[model samples]
Target: MTVATFDTAVIGGGLVGCWTALFLARRGARVAILEKGSVGAQSSGTNFGNLRLQGRFPGQYPLSLRSQAIWEQLQDFVGSACEYERTGHLYCAFDEGEAEKLEGYAKVSESYGLSIERLGREDLKHRYPWLADKVTAATFSARDATANPRLVTPAVARAARDAGASVFENIRVSEVRKSGSGFELRADPDLRIHCANVVNAAGAWAVEIAEQFGETAPLFAAGPPQFVTEPFPYFMSPSVQTIDGSVIVRQTRRGNLILAGYPRTAADPASQRVPVPPQKTLAAMKRLAELAPVLRSCSVIRVWSGTEGYLPDMVPVIGASETTPGLWHAFGFCGHGFQIGPGVGLCLSEMILDGGTETPLEPFGIGRFRSGVAVSEKFRREFDERKTA
Candidate 1:
């Protein structure tokens, strides 16, 4: 079969891949997104729809803040009504220690012009009457918001198509290679195609694919299973997290609660399909009971799991591929990619079409790990702590 040629070939149809394709095509690059499954079928679809700015590492705060800004203007960018709102996100601290952590995070995040207020007992009760009695204080970051992952991913893919990009679903990118000035990508169990550039946005699978072309990074994954309660009322949650790390509940605009914490299965290298075990559901519900007693017995009609990619340092490698000349990466986001996905995509696209990103992709370059490359002292100190954390 004769293969198609394009300016760029994106190797994953998850959120990152779709965004890369959409923006590249918008910039006049003929693009094709090859998805092993349906768009967002992987962790992209499974992720809890929380577009948050709280609990973010200080370095990532700025980039994430920009992405969150774009999220506010997503409707204007996509020219479609995206289900998103910045109703606010809160981090619940059941004790003094938890509250203390919030204080440190607040001071660190202040440079980004982000506001994080510590909530007292009365403040907690006044804001969310459903808050559990155990909740002593909460940190509120009203700048954060959420969007329906299911709705957003497909909408992005559709917008990409409308803007002149092709999306091929159920086609796995079997192999990738550097061919002269471009990239040669083989899909399906093996269908060869070529493009001027390739974007490795395969989420969890990104590590292995980059390895295939002799470009590897320390990317690990763990699947976290969660359950959601049926619609109750339009209750705003601001994102919720516990000192015990037991549960996090964010009420959707539709009144349903997106719950997490106490995921059933651990990260399994064998299977991405995670089963929400009864134990996990019970744990989530119990925590919900402790946090929002009113939702303790809130019947849950749906349970699912999502696998998140993690780098050894817990940050994303958002710019380039070392071994391949015309390749780049926008993966290993752990759980924070959604908030940073768009801005990363825009910056990464510029780097690919040109040579560098104005947003400082230098710290994120894959070349840092080359055998002869020395680790940056600052990067070393930072990563060492993340490893310990």
Candidate 2:
């Protein structure tokens, strides 16, 4: 077997792993990315592409804002726009209870120095005349944006390769064990990878790797159902969603409205299959129409979903391993990994190279799961009780 050496080995080629490799390679590290399949072909590529900042977990504001900064400069960093746009994000409220939730979310965002605009029913009608009368209140954040999920990971991987990082696709890592002061990764087709540090950003399949080091998390596989309508007139700009976690929709410049909703469907990582239930499609369609009456007639041209790791607490596991040195984990992001992917990568690179990052990652530490995990309300509301894996 041929053995390749690197300063850091990133296991997974999704946005988080690819961006980690890119930043590490840029810092003059010998980096290699081992992916089971093509980069971004899974969850990273199939996401709804909402780079939202509003309504994030309070502890995640710093990281989310940092990630948005990178998204704003993606073209210069990765040499592609990836269809990124700061078209803003509008979170609507259907009832007074939902409106209060929006207000609390806006306050949380404001504390992080993010500008949030609260809009009443008349304000929503004036700005988004297409919205239905039931949308009683809303909040808008210009900082929230969108991008092409399908294009980002590949572009970042190319940049990583350009910066002297080796990217090995279609390579499934079968075993990873600590070797002396470094680690050794054994993969299919008879290849060995040795590295001083290892980052397991393996998305849905990351828990298996973490368990190898005596670390465990209540990670499950699930994905939001996504649908896209046939091209129509381009009018809707901002990404819009309901505060009650019903549906989210955004229109492409090409006039197709992309829609996604909660009560995410369960996924199977072993089979590499993520099936979007027919009932979810119908329910999301109804919610979208209720949110915006004008889009009721829009025909859905396609529907899809992908496997994503979700923790019971609805938080991602990041930072160094609790039991193993030089090993880091960044996975189980639920379905919100796309927007914060870049920032997480950058932070990982800093931790690997510069010793630590300024970002507050203590909340996402793997040690939190040591004493059993608590299920979050958001998790309960966003996912079906039976569908979770």
lDDT, candidate 1, 1-389, per-residue tens: 54889988888888888888888989989999998878987677777777878777677776787678778888976776567878687888877887888778778767789887878999978877878888898888888888878778788899899999998998977778778888788777557788888888888888878887777776666655667888987765577877444677788767888887743254554566656667778777877887888886688889887766766555778777766677888887866777788788777788878787667556666665564344433334434343211
* Model 2: per-residue Cα lDDT over 1-389, one tens digit each: 88999999999999999999999999899999999999998899999999999999999999999999999999999999999999999999989999999999999999999999999988888899999999999999998899999999999999999999999999999899999999999998899999999999999999889999999888888888899999989999899989867798999999999999888888888998888878888888999989988878888889998889998889899899989989999999988899999999999999999889999998999899878677898787655467433
Q: How far off is residue 364 in model 2, in Å? A: 0.4
Model 2 RMSD vs true structure: 1.1
Question: What TM-score against the true fold does each predicted structure earn?
Answer: 0.90, 0.98
TM-score of 1: 0.90
Q: What is the lDDT of candidate 2?
A: 0.92
Worst 10 residues of 1 by lDDT: 380-389
**Candidate 2 lowest-lDDT run of ten:** 380-389
Count of backbone clashes for each model? 6, 0
Query: Which pairs of residues collide in candidate 1?
Result: 88-238, 89-238, 89-239, 90-238, 90-239, 222-267
Off by over 4 Å in 1: 262-264, 267-271, 367-389
lDDT of each: 0.76, 0.92
